[model samples]
Target: MDEKLIQRLESAIARLESLSPGSKPPSGTLDAVSAASEPSIVAYDDLLVEYVVKVSLAAEKIGGQVHDITIVLSQAFATQKELLMKIKQTQKPDGGGMTEFLKPLNDKLAQANNMSEGKRSDFFNHLKAASESLSALIWIAYTGKGCGKQKLLLLTSYFPIFNINLASKQQLFALIFSGMSMPIGHVEECWQSAEFYNNKVLVEYKNKDPYHVEWAKALKELYVPGLRDYVKAHYPLGPLWSTTGAVVSAPKSAQPSAPNPPSASLANLASSSSSRPKQGQGMAAVFQEISSKPVTSGLRKVTDDMKTKNRKDRAGFVSSGENEVQKSAPKTAAKTGPPKLELVMGRKWVVENQIGVKDLLIDDCDPKQTVYIFGCKDSVLQIKGKVNNITVDKCTKMGVLFTDVVAAFETVNCSSIEVQCQGAAPTISIDNTAGCQLYLSRESLETSITTAKATEVNVMVPSSDPDADLAEHPLPQQYIHTYQDGNFVTNPVSHSGG
Candidate 1:
């Protein structure tokens, strides 16, 4: 066992005792996750090398960032590999969690509690960008393609699968901690007990889930091969990929052979594994569920509430305009303001009314479908949802609160912009922010920013390993150039609907 690593893991757990809710560390804690380089990778055998390189190249074709897989994702697999090897020796699982998985993100958010909306938004945007940029890479990894050679390397020490004791449990822990949500289905292999149903997180495992526990063959057979198939179909590239030898020069030892596409031979892998999920049976995503829908009752209810609010908010927004506030910026503040909204979830939610009075804490908001919030000022605001076109109107003394969100929450016109998302891509337009704080996420949107406003744009990735950048991050920012209409945006915000 690597005693130092164990000690570090133990110490990280120890710090949780003093940890409180919403606690965050000082600045520079979160490095630009997307911008982070790959971890120190051990070279792979030739066959694996060629295939992995092809996989990496395929990722670029699919619009996924290849480096994220090489850097963030490859490291995740490496970490899992190292931990699993230790587990096999002891034949026991390590324990400790929640904070173990989430503390890095939580700690930072807590620290920024007092930041003004502008400052908070800047921070949040960066975090969101890093997380989002890593999405596809993560999904590819989750499928177990990344786990292959590591498993092979450990078993034979020669890089071929034999006498393998798969690390399903450890992999699950790694996946969840990597910001992938827990699937509601039973884990056939190894799982202690952690559920993420809606925003209400539920995690309960004694000593946290262990790092070194190997799963049984029966269960492993049921899971691994199917996952390999999924990886073959979707990502096809490698957490293990290396480029062609002749094209790129490396020390002869590290040089890759000619790259060949994934061959048909890999398709039959599950043959020996035993009753895997048949195509429609959804076994392909053995470790995790394929559907993006919420599985648990708790998650469903939360999604329901979000949709319900969207309906109401959409209604209100379509019906009313902040007629009192003129389109043109006023030299002097208006004495009279628009009608006040109830300013709570469900009742006055959907953010159509005067937003200056109340803070916005919303979740599951669909950016493509509705215009959620616009033109608010001088209030603490926190909105959580999938990334979509957001038109943030002007606000003085504005404050935006950012919690760790699953998707991108790109804003259009907020004076101060900060976004932090896990597995989300966030973009900010320079059309509005000038001399305003703009900490856009690491993989920010494409629109040009002419201003040199002390905008604080940086990617804040939440990882115990400062270098860990996620692969399955967010999508690109949708920039529709049309101007805002009123309390509602006039531009069509649809992206994937096409």
Candidate 2:
């Protein structure tokens, strides 16, 4: 929201476009570049990839509900797309016909006679712009298509303090997996509501609901060395707020004028209304142009002629310079897929590196991967954390136990998840986590938890009192409490407090 900050981020897009143009970068390049201990690109240069992924997420119909970040990002995507169009236009002959290619030669002759060097300089400028634009697009497109979107969306949904939501079923996902966090503190922001015409305000927590405190406690568990860690190690992605999966619109056949940014409104980039059209749609359209189009048979003769001419020219210009030993050395190809991965349908697997996967399925199997996500709605997940940072989804007859150091656990659009926190610092984030509880435990105390998106999250934190009897302090109605008595235990209620 700061004026100076807006001006800084606003110039970032232009700097990125000016740097290079070509197809987008390779799929793993962005991640590899970002994750390196030392990054090659400077501060705002990172925003380029993030915006492209946002566009790709939009193409897949995901929206980040945060207003300011999305507005800035959407406009950035538009600006880059327009620049790419110009680069493409510059490569093609103007006024296309049989006479188009001859114009360059004619211009060269005209320049030689008139002693005008502007055409010569202009030729190099176009090449420079195209090279930069094409390269930028390639990196952006690869990230948008290959980034693990499902995990990214799930990670940001749990914290109640953040203003974000899933707008439609398209944004909804099933089959999450995870475990463990420790409850820590209370919120002291001193937020309040207004009174009447007396012009006074009442402080919040005046009524002091115990249930509210419990919720806050659970939420705080997620706040520390949290999802931000996951994001920092990857792209600086903004949280997605909506799920209205918009269709990727095809590119227009007829050329349109390049989109121009508002000259006086660099500060207003935060306005949600100022965002450009769906960029993922435009990127997808461009992708179609690059991938699906086939060269015509008629163009083959022209291509062969160009290659033969190049060969003849090279042979005439240079003598042979290759040594017999150097020529015999084998060329190396790049490696793809996880180099250390070992797989099977059976259990017992160990992996110490990050695993990038999509539409991933693992049923009746043990856990130990970086991220596991749901592609189909009916997909089931088994969240046994032999690895770290997981989401437990669709908890029907499932025993959700929090053990060890689980930074955050979020559940949404699934059946029922059993609640049991026996871990150190666990935050159970319930966003649209419907159904009911199958269990709750005592160790949930001192764990920070937050809730958002979901209508209700059923938490079952039991009393760990040694001397106190059940008859002395009656349990609250929200608890599914039980004790060693005359078989008289019912309803979930009455949790412990700090």
Candidate 3:
């Protein structure tokens, strides 16, 4: 009756119209079916099986069988939609020509609505029969031959209990487009002539053989209560659950409440009075003298200090070596070398040199080399003499013997050194005790200066902590060139492994 409902009716009818003569089938039906039959379909079949399992699980959770309830529920939704469309499209004196066309449909819809629930169920059963006919028609359309009786039976067995009227493309579309304006007879005629399916194919209406007594019993159990108690007990949705809509309830039990404790002062006095002995004060005297007092802050301080020490000991940071990296330096580089750099690919790299200007070049590499470099921590190492294919691990050890080296790819092993730049200016300066001050262009340096002479004995230092004084004490010069193991025509020879 409302505009929105009317629009839905109109849309449904239009959809039905399109489905009138011939409409498109489900987009991937053929592919899905073909793929289902192939050996390779196992992979996709796994996905389908998973969904089917989930469907069964959901049905079990709701106390119903997946194949049964879905049919009735879907039917209910379709019937509701049809009733709505009919109500909206009901013709009036002022209604337009479209309304006149919708008049007969309104009467049929009213009749369908007035039918008893059992009658509706019968109608749905009829719709299901029609749907099977349609399915066979489609098979014939695709294969140009009528499906056999056994094939029809197999198809029927596989078909889940879905409401054909609710699920049908033509019916749903008609509900939307014509607003129940078209007569039911016309709708039936459209489906009859549609080439969508081959009616010549045999049809099967039952999941089980009709002659089976148990099959009839199961069918009866679906709608009846009490008579099928044994069957209902085994069914997931339980026979009684659907028919009687009854839920099991447990007997209620009263819980007792705990008695409240006496106030703190009263409890304390009572404890003192009860504990009075020959060596202690009398109970009456202790009770008379008792008075409330606040806890002192000094006691709390002692307790807090004890807790702090306990935590410190538990964490292992109380030991000197465990917290070595966090200690302050004496403003002097270790005789060994600066801390090593961990190169992690994908993360940004900051490589700069102190003392003098040096050129460093980098290039994209092949898959193997890319993996080796990118897998590195912090930043990748540069192998000496190898353009882009060498491993830094094979070129050099963590030592700074050269001083004049400008640039060379060399392998070095060292740990990282952390310094805090305490409230100092952002710019950093590299200075040497040997009377030479190096101005680095950037905060960090990354290079393999193997060919040029070593400039400094310092390299492999981490960025200063946000509060450290890196500007005051400059980094030492690191070995820029490699101490070649032997004379070779080429600087870098490929090594199989690091």
For model 2, the stretches where C-alpha displacement exceeds 4 angstroms are 1-166, 169-387, 395-397, 438-443, 467-498
> Which candidate gets the maximum TM-score versus the true structure?
2
Q: Candidate 2, after superposition: displacement of residue 113 in Å? A: 54
Error of 2 at 46 (Å): 13
Full-model lDDT, candidate 1 = 0.33
What's the C-alpha lDDT at position 337 in model 1? 47
lDDT value for model 2? 0.32
lDDT of each: 0.33, 0.32, 0.29
Tens-digit per-residue lDDT, 1-498, candidate 1: 365346445545544532546665432222211111112111112212333333334333423232332233234333433322222222211112211322233223222221212322312322222222222222322223234332222212211222211322344345444433211111212222111110011011112222101111111221234333433532343233223211212235433478897665544666535535547656557645435435663343356656756666555454435764464346334533453423344322334335456555656554332223545665555656543333344444455544332222334445554433333332233333423443333434332233222233333334445577633323223335654554434452455655
Q: Write the per-residue lDDT of candidate 2 for residues 199-296, one digit (tens) a residue.
A: 10011111323332232222222122222232344333321211332222223543356899657665666554444445667776666655655667
Model 3, 1-498: lDDT tens digits are 265346446545655554555765463443333323333223223322333233334334334222344333233323323322232223211112222322333333323223311322212223332233222111111111221232222222333225332334344344334432112222233344321111111111122123222222332222222112212232222111122222222223322358797767878898777655444556755555443324462254456646755766667454567456455343333322343333335422223211111222233332122112111223322323112112122111111111111112122221221112111112222211122222222322433222111233333233357455335433324424454667434342333586
Best-fitting candidate, scored by lDDT? 1
Q: Worst ten-residue run, lDDT, model 3?
A: 136-145
Which 10-residue window of candidate 1 scores lowest in summed lDDT? 195-204
| Cα RMSD for predicted model 2 | 28.5
What ranking emerges by TM-score with the best candidate at the front? 2, 1, 3
